[model samples]
Target: MERLKKLMVGLILLCLFISCSQKNNKSDGKLKVVTTTTMLTDLVKTIGGDKVVVTGLMGEGIDPHLYRASAGDVDKLSKADVIIYGGLHLEGKMAEIFEKLPELGKQVLNVGESLDKSKIHFIQENTPDPHVWFNTDLWETEAKAVTKKLSEMDVKNSGYYNQNYEKYKKELERLGEYITNRIKEIPKNSRVLVTAHDAFGYYGEKFGLEVKAIQGVSTDSETGTKNILELANFIVQRNIKAIFVESSVPKKSIEALQEAVKSKGSEVKIGGELYSDSLGDKEHNTDTYIKMVKANTDVIVDALK
Candidate 1:
């Protein structure tokens, strides 16, 4: 009954938005792109440059996994020239809405879904991890995909988009090198990353860290007492120097794990907040994708070293 009611409300909003968009068909002569996560927003802005006006539905510290599209979000999406999102169920609650957008004639790009299946990491037999941005190589591929989409949509500005992508690609290469070097500062055994959730699996695999978490990939997943206890024991057994809290996930689970560590006669520090599912704001110097990843690397290296 609840799902039906929500669906009805969405349909009504979609109709109203479509009507309003048709009535006010004023063009700024730029492609209006709607992105689901801040990461994608930054990517589009970096590649699209002055050619696209990008609006991000999820802002800094917003968890995409638990994010549901509001009426305003639906309206924004309905009016977009193109909609791009991190697929692989990253935006768990908004999956249905994304599916319906293409049916409404909206050009939609599922960045994660466009990747080669072999490159994606599967946490379970069939469930692939959605946090591909952590792997710089994979993120470079996603950036290329975005460039291709923007060029296809705005052929006149294809050259401009390609140029921006080439420049940004070099920046990403530098960022990858920086991450690899910074991660090496930590001793091999001490390179273990303990976090509130399993969002850093890609980061761990990419940079050679062993990652453990009290919760699963999605923040919507529950954290049981047993899970917390087990993670705490692992931390104690490994003598991990520091654990991390995610910008979008609650700190309580990590805090509880800290208490469990204490009960087991070991201590662990909350290293620093890592930008897992979202980026930090400008005030924190992590507004851009490169800055966010660099800031996270600095935090991790500083804490674990």
Candidate 2:
């Protein structure tokens, strides 16, 4: 009878251990998520909160247009439960690899791909400008798409994701209104936003500012002498006071424009650097998307107001 009792106790303990292991596996063994850019990682964190482990392939200040994923990156992505990328060909060399990853049964989400087809303007063959984050209104839509995808993948935490997403979406909407109101402070004629590249078309379009670029839509586009001359002439003719440089692009382009204007007896200052391709350093005010827009707003307001 004593031996039987001991055996029964051991069986009960084993069953309890198995049940505990199963419960833990169901709750928090870590749901691995991989994002193509730091921007997406920020959005994912806003939705996933601490329930998911998120990693960004591109670091802060890194331009997504020229990024080449390493072998280690491939291995990391291969292990993810979901792979989220900006798509719209923003990944450049990694585009094909991302498209094919879904074959491995990973949930590959192209957040920008969910945009309304009519609202998209293609910058290249089968590629829409991946800089959709410029328009806070548009970005709120994308954030909702991200929340839906993440919730679908990890339904156990759906409520948490939905709540966080709602909060973030409200913040994004407030940011949009803030920009619209602050930009109104600048004289209507002074609303010209000139930058190294044409990244701000959406921002300008959304906020009622005139956007000009020394380079084409992509920073990868080489600035031609004709383009520089024309931009300088426009600045001189319009009496545009400030030309902005982007943090990720070379300042030489903007400097050249400044010199061109100066040679023609017109003065145009470099309106503080804007966070164009990527957000500013992790410690800076432009670290988060909201902070980034505010930093850019402050610079634009001070320069153009």
Candidate 3:
């Protein structure tokens, strides 16, 4: 009986020790960083290396424009050691909430906000374009800014951040080259990108394509029959091969245009859904900015070619 009691006591102590060790391991893991978009989260993951645990608040195909911060999201934000957002009012309704995060003493990094004011094209003079990721070269600058913020947050991991940032920058440069080469495959005059909205302006500017949309920059912009008719007419007149539907926005607008074009005896194919305002599934390659751009390029090439 005495031996059995001793064995039980040893087992209990072992279990307690294991439990405490797991708790400490979790505590020592890394600083929790939450980003508004998958692109930002991926970049943070690269720069932060093993020193940060990054998560995207927006999930696959989730529209940042229409996104509302849920109670669970708030709880996530509250627990984060640092939060990163694409800024430039990309979050739309959630903008005010993010603006208040710094007031709560949480380190908030608005990486796009560091862009040169002169380079940014705004919906209004005060509101900058949030689609910086579309311009891969420009995104490098944003990544550097993010790297700086990560270093500031965890100075001990500064060396790792710097090393990783350099590696990430090279990858971005490679992606830019690949996009340039792929876009070149499209006939010069056929290089027109028409979508539900003006989300691809940066993309067009970067890749030498003419871009047009029925709605303006914001998905919240109202569309009317006249706008639909106008876009259909333009598509038919230009003989553009494809029009893309955004993953976040409704397809009704694009469908209306397609029907209008068909009535005019011109058939413009609907290009596969594009990841404009959000990333692809986390398990997929397009879940990050680099992969998102590559996915878009592939779809665009397939449709246009």
Computed on alpha carbons, the lDDT of every model, listed in order, comes to 0.89, 0.82, 0.81
Model 1 stretches with alpha carbons more than 4 Å out: 5-17, 20-26
Lowest lDDT sum, 10 consecutive residues, model 3, at: 16-25
Residue 144 Cα positional deviation in candidate 3, in Å, after optimal superposition: 0.6
lDDT per residue (tens digit) for residues 207-258 in model 3? 8999888888878779888998888888888899999998888898889889
lDDT, candidate 3, residue 229? 89
What RMSD does each model have against the real structure?
A: 1.7, 12.8, 11.8
Q: Which stretches of candidate 3 lie over 4 Å from their true place?
A: 1-26, 282-284
Question: Residues 1-305, candidate 1, lDDT per residue (tens digit)?
Answer: 87885776588556744744574463889999999999999999999999899999998889999987777787787678889999998998877777776666678999986689998888798777899999988999999999999999999999999999999999999999999999999999899999998988889999899888888888888999999988888989899989998889989999999999999998999999999988898899999999999999999999998
TM-score winner: 1
TM-score, predicted candidate 1 vs. hidden true structure: 0.95
The global Cα lDDT (0 to 1) of model 1 is 0.89
TM-score rank, highest first? 1, 2, 3
Question: Which model, 1 or 2, shows the larger lDDT?
Answer: 1
